[model samples]
Target: MYNIHWEEKALHELEKLDSKVSSRIFKKVESLKEGLHLSDIKRLKNSDYFRLRVGDYRIIFSFEDNTITVWKVGHRNHIYDRI
Candidate 1:
């Protein structure tokens, strides 16, 4: 299983979401500990980070040394803007 490390920005974004939505996202992210073979996960083009889609939100993260570091989290429309 991979360890999860949340970056400040990602955590902040997640905190801004509705409780139900945030919990749902958290569960999905936690599920990554099993593996990244889930259908919602995909590698970002021309980038080292991978993205996990959950509902209309997107999680930007990278995995290394058995750790998954979340860099950002936001709505699909704006998640890629600053990445």
Candidate 2:
């Protein structure tokens, strides 16, 4: 099992999303605790970050030492800009 941590900025971004979208995102994050692999995850070039897709939004995170740190959450258009 991996511990999931959310950066303050990521949490704030989530809070600004629609409730339904937020709920789905939460569910997907929780699934990471159950041992999800990185087969479908897209790695950001030249970075330690990876991305998980949830509908039109994206979850940007990094994994290290049994911990996953979510750095940002936003729609596709602006998510990469912040990263």
Candidate 3:
């Protein structure tokens, strides 16, 4: 199984999201470490990375070595507002 790394950037993103959605997003991240690669992950570009849709929010992340690092989490309309 791969290791999941929650960078301060990602953790901060989680803090800004709704509780239920945040929980679900984390669950999915954990599952991915266990080898669940869905269409969403498969569709990622080499430089683009993976993204999961939680309502209108997007969980953006990437993998390095055996670690999955979540990069950002934000609504479809608000993602660009981050950073």
Candidate 3 structure quality by residue, lDDT tens digits, 1-83: 89988889889989887899888888877888877467555435555567767667777777878888888877878764563
lDDT of 1: 0.95
Pick by TM-score: which candidate is best? 1
In model 1, the worst 10-residue window by lDDT is 33-42
Best by lDDT: 1
Q: What digit string (tens of lDDT, one per residue) describes model 1 on residues 1-83?
A: 89999999899999999998899899999999998889999999999999999999999999999999999988999999989
**Residue 50 in candidate 1 has what lDDT?**
96
Per-residue alpha-carbon lDDT of candidate 2 for residues 1-83, written as tens digits (9 for 90 to 100): 99999999999999999999999998898788867584657899999899999989999999898898999999999999987
RMSD of each: 0.6, 1.1, 2.4
Predicted structure 2, TM vs. truth? 0.94
Which residue segments of model 2 deviate by more than 4 Å? none
lDDT per model vs. reference: 0.95, 0.91, 0.76
- Model 2, position 49, has a per-residue lDDT of 96
lDDT of 1 at 4: 98
Question: TM per model?
Answer: 0.97, 0.94, 0.78
